[model samples]
Target: WSSSLGGVRLINAYGPTETVITATCYDVPRDETLPDRFRGVPIGTANANRLLYVLDRHLNPLPPGLPGELCIGGENLAMGYHKRPDEEKKVFVPDPFRPQGRLYRTGDKVRMHGNGLIEFLGRVDQQVKIRGFRIEPGEVENILAGHPHLETALVAVKTDAHGEKQLVGYFRPRAGSRPEISEIRAFMQKQLPPYMIPAAFIELDTIPLLPGGKVNRRALPVPEDLRGQLSAEYVAPRTETEEELAAIVSSVLRIEKVGVYDNFFELGGHSMLGTQVMSQIQEKFGVEVPLRVLFENPTVDGIAAAITEALTQSIDEEELAGLLGDVTDLNDDDLNALLNDE
Candidate 1:
């Protein structure tokens, strides 16, 4: 767009109202061609007389590429908010670098590049802690939007039925292209860690937008069930052990059904939930499955096999054979009844 404006220099300016408008400005290069994975344009250097500091929670400066809160100090800084002293005290803090000077905490997460340009990561308020990892939804949204089949992508934290927070991806497919949930999951898996991958991908024809053109997060529909959005196909339990394990997983994750090959973490299972699963496994299977085992195996079939191995080690071959025979002879109702009895 800047290239089309023959002689005009397009500058991207960033600032909050508290900073008296523009604090930092970036000169957009006329011949710039954005890369496929471009996260965002740099906010550039501080304006004249203004100081930009990318600082950690302690107001200590962060090294390049390390994300932290953006704090502004120096000349252009506002005195304070009008009659909002309590709020002012929260955001406007005394500058450790400059005695008697105040820095406005922008509440914006950013990282400085080696070139001294600042890259806006996202708002600090938008960051969510999931599975003990601090994640910026914009990071996932940026990667998900890079998928060939997606037109746009948005990620938000939604609490699942298990009272656990889970990442849910909402996306609009490119014109005339319908992307499979499994394909989207695969695309994200390659670029993200297991915990970062969304538990569900919901297709949207158009992402709801507010009058001001921002995404209407409150209007986004909640997914009824996440099982259909998983990367794995629905593979029913083939054995009594698998059936029991699947039931436990389904109940814990609050999903309708869990396939034998379905991943536990992919279904929003975290370390905290893994402990609960281990407790249930010991109670129901009469064998101790460590929390690490669930993380390592992370599948109904794998956990069932682990349980079988644990049980086998505790008993003789003849006893194991008899137990297997007894389980194989039971129907679904009888098995459920037996498990309930246990």
Candidate 2:
């Protein structure tokens, strides 16, 4: 697009309010193709009299290609926030790299390219921990943006009715496209591991944006119910085992209904919750079920089948134990006769 402007130069500027204006600038090259790994345009190197440092949580400098919190130092930084001492202390701190300067933590996650250009990953606060896995929503959003049916996508961590944190994907479908939640879910499954997948996907006509054109996360509607997010259509439990298994899954997930084909992980089930489900199954069925059984067969029907098999094995073991006990009590002549019969 810049090529059409003739002598015009397109510049990408990046800075936080605390930086007292633009701290970095990138002269976007015309007709330049960015590598596939870069999620967005590079914010470029620091401007004159400005210092940019990408550091980890411990204030240690991170190597290039590693995402970390962006800290701005040197003459461009503000003198902390007014009348907000507590908040100021958290973000503005002494620079570890310099002897006489302070760095304002931008709370922006970014990584430096090998060529020294800085690429913005996302906001540090947007990173979330779900099911023991720390996830950057921007990473998932980047993958979602590649889907042919989606025009744009945003992922955020939302608390469900049960007070559990879940990743919910909000997306706008491409023009003239009405993509199903199941199709989106399948696309995500192919690109990401189970833990990285969003628990629910909501279709939005237009994602709310602030005046600056950034996503207005607070404006995104809370899903009234998550049943619509399931990849499979709701099918009520038909068998006694299915009914029991469905009850367990519903209780664990804090969702009202579970279907025979509904996947456990897709319904927000994780390793911790899977353990609880397995424990309850063992107590109810009086048989041991391995943890991997849930991962292999996450649906209610699949779990019910595992439980049924476990129960059958238990019964068979008991019958074998009884036969052994009878043999133990047999006299020497009877034992010999039994051996001969066998």
Candidate 3:
């Protein structure tokens, strides 16, 4: 490794904000890969006097080789984030292993090794933000892996040429089995939200792995198009409202094209993204649409009708307001005029 780096020493450091700075360092060897190289780099033992503890979600210390959050309790650890008492109290809890001592809960998922090293696993919270929506890719992968045709699955976030983040899934099939992308997509649609479904699927004979047995994600090839598994024929938007709504959903979902009659939920929309879609419609067309309206009318054609209805209601309300003329009471003649005008 030093030969590629022109003969320089490289050090890997690990710590949390609560620790003020780094608490451990690893001197990388040239040929032998570190025993604890996982999430990014190996977090070696605590330096000097600092103590590192691996504990489960309930703050119970786990035996070596079990995955848990790495908690730090030592002199080097700072009290907590300043002015973030609510957050501070959540992470900096009384040490379960040591009586009356403070332990900083590092959100990182890691497992202790028998060699006195810790390997990073991943974030305790696997939620990933893509196009303003916090998505859980693991949830999608779990659904994909559950398919009988699939052996294993890996999901990742990829950016298309349009600068939009899209979820892409890669999977390997069982021996003597070949699964269609459309079949996998139909399987995912049964339980997952539209946003969680991958925009593209790539089949692999075998997943590439690193020397450390981790997936070599960078080696995976990019899919050619955004039309992952939706087998519908191309249908253009018929109305101006349909065209506008399709554009919004396509951009949000990172798909190249969408149909006017396509179900928004079927196209990967969720509650939070539904709010965005509704907000944009209101801003663009000057009509406030309730969240339930979108749920009830999921298609572009359906929503366009709702928009027209809202506008007509607004016109009727305005006419009624004008006829009343801010008066406290309306006579029969005034009410009759308003009714006749309608």
Candidate number achieving the greatest lDDT relative to the actual structure: 2
Error of 1 at 177 (Å): 4.1
Mind giving the per-residue lDDT tens digits that candidate 2 earns over 119-196? 988888877788789899888888888788888888887887778788888999888999888888888888898899
For candidate 2, the per-residue lDDT at 43 reads 92
Total clashing pairs for each candidate: 0, 0, 2
Q: Per-residue lDDT for 138-190 in model 3, tens only? A: 65665677788877888877776666677888998988889888788888877
Q: What are the TM-scores, per candidate, against the unseen true structure?
A: 0.82, 0.86, 0.54
Using TM-score as the measure, the top candidate is 2
Question: Considering TM-score, where higher is better, how would the candidates rank from best to worst?
Answer: 2, 1, 3
lDDT of each: 0.86, 0.88, 0.77
Q: Look at candidate 2 and give me any clashing residue pairs.
A: none
Winner on lDDT between 2 and 3 is 2
Better of 2 and 3 by TM-score: 2
Give candidate 1's root-mean-square deviation (CA, Å): 10.1
- What lDDT does model 1 reach? 0.86
- Cα-based lDDT at residue 47, candidate 2: 95
